[model samples]
Target: MKGLLLRWLILTLAILAAAYLIDGIAVAGFPSALAAAALLGILNALLRPLLLLLTLPLNILTLGLFTFVINALLLMMVSGVIGGLKIQGFGSALLASLVISLVSWLLTTLVGNEGKMDVIVLQRRDEDHWE
Candidate 1:
């Protein structure tokens, strides 16, 4: 549950960052960004897999490049559903999706699956020798 909320927050921040960086993507404010993020999450959860399955041949044909087109389509859908969020066109949606995905990936890597900072633990035993 906490992890889900953290992911949602990360998505919101990613959306805001994309809007900030992209000229054709506009988010009116934080509320809008939050709403857009939620909508995007829901859409990705419900629609993305279906779309991917349906477009498998195309996806394979392009070596998965078509997935980006599917992402742009989802972004366009979100813009249509959310009033305060606006995406100009397919090109803009594609670029914005790329930025948002990159930001989200970076943030999620920092945050572990349980909504906590990710840390690596190592232990050395007497039987283990240094190289």
Candidate 2:
């Protein structure tokens, strides 16, 4: 449960970052960003898989690049559903989706699957061995 909340917060931050960086994407405020993130998560959880399965052929043909289109479409749908989040056009949606995906992925890597900051440290125990 804590991990889920952390993940959601990460997503909210990503949305805010996208709005900040993308000219065509607008988020009313933090509350709006939170709501948008939650809706986006729900949609991704429920609808994304179905859409991916339906578009498997095209996805394969495009070497999985078609996933970006699917993500953009979903982002546009989220904008339509959320009153506070606005995407000007398909191009904006595409760019915003890319930004959001990148930010989310980068943050998630730092946070790890358990939603806690993960760190790795290496030490040399001997001349020929490291631990």
Candidate 3:
């Protein structure tokens, strides 16, 4: 529980920093930033996977680039849900989403993993006879 909360806190800070970078992804202040983070998380959880699935053909057609547009749309939808958050237009949304993705990827890389969780073993270490 504590670890989960801590991870959420880290994510909140990342989102706040991202919103700072993007002009239209504003929150009134700290409180609003936190609220926006929560809203963003909820939307991503509930909507993102579905959107990805629905847009799979388009995503493949664009060699995965269309996923960026889908992500931007989700971010804009988040702004719609949260009062102080706003993404001006699709172009702004696309730019902001790219910025957010870059920042979040950097932060996640810096932080590393804190627990055992669900994920594919994309690469496996070579095995030996009890070595």
Candidate 4:
């Protein structure tokens, strides 16, 4: 629906911003960046969850830090899918991923929480409204 498309665009913009902040995250232009963003979304949707599940023990052992590596790998895979989105090397990809995540997190989290998105605000008119 329209909401999904909007979210996709927002994510694309976030990635584009992140690319500007970090090295090795390349897109030729706006169109290329958009395409690469969509590809990244697709790759994350298709692959990331499985990787997380497979690496659950590692994730647990690492206190969920291993998820960052998985995310970086997914970003690199996305670069491979989108021809113009080139990551120079694994380390670069990892660093770019970290930057991308941090930037996106900061933007989305700016409304209220610190580094947490998907936030919903509820206004209470009366204390009894929650009952």
Candidate 5:
């Protein structure tokens, strides 16, 4: 549950970052960003799989790049439902989606599944063996 909340917060931050970086994406405030993130998460969990399966051929043809289009559509849908979030057009949604995904991915990587910062250190215990 804590991990879930952490992930949600990360996504909310990502949404805020997207709003900050993208010209056509507007988030009214932090509350709106939180709501948008939650809705986007729900939609991604509930609807994305079906959409992906339905568009498998196109997705395959584009070597999975079409997933970005699906993501953009979902972002647009979220904006439509969230009163405080606004996407000017499909192009804006696409760019915003890219930004959101990138930010979310980067933060999530830093905060691993356990909801803590993950760091790896490598040391050479011996010339022949490293651990």
Candidate 6:
């Protein structure tokens, strides 16, 4: 669907931003970034839940910070599988994950879940008054 493609494009942009801002994470090019984003999306959808459930105690102990660790691991997994994407260390992966998550969240918030802008209209009613 259009929404899905928009989300994926946002994610790819996030990945590129992270790679640019971070020192140890390297993306060969836009194609690699696209592939990485797709792989990340698939992994997050298919594997993240299981990892979260398995690491619930740790996640709870860290007040959900361990979720970042899970995300970093997933990034590392993708790096291993993708030749053009390289993450030099766990620290790099963790930082990249954080950056990607933030950028993706910001972009998604701006784009909306449906990938379209919604307009809202408000009208004054008899029971309503300006403060």
Deviation in angstroms for 70 in model 1?
A: 0.8
Clashing pairs in 1: none
lDDT of 6 by residue, 3-75 (tens): 8899889999999999999999999999999999999999999999999999999999999999999999999
Top TM-score model: 5
Tens digits of lDDT, candidate 3, 1-131: 76665556655676677678877666667776677767777778899899999989988999999978987887788778778777778887888778777776666666646733434445445663332
In candidate 2, residue 111 scores what lDDT? 87
lDDT of 6 at 120: 61
Model 1 poorest ten-residue lDDT run: 122-131
lDDT of 5 at 58: 99
TM-score of each: 0.87, 0.88, 0.75, 0.76, 0.89, 0.87
Error of 6 at 12 (Å): 0.5
- Give me the runs in candidate 2 sitting further than 4 Å from their true place: 120-131
Runs in model 6 deviating more than 4 A are 117-131
Clashing pairs in 2: none
Worst lDDT run of 10 residues, candidate 6, spans 122-131
Error of 2 at 74 (Å): 0.9
lDDT of 6: 0.93
> What C-alpha root-mean-square deviation, in Å, does candidate 2 show against the real structure?
2.5
What is candidate 2's lDDT per residue for 71-125, written digit by digit as tens? 9999899999999999999999888888989999999989877666898899999
What is the RMSD of candidate 6?
A: 3.8
RMSD of 5: 2.9
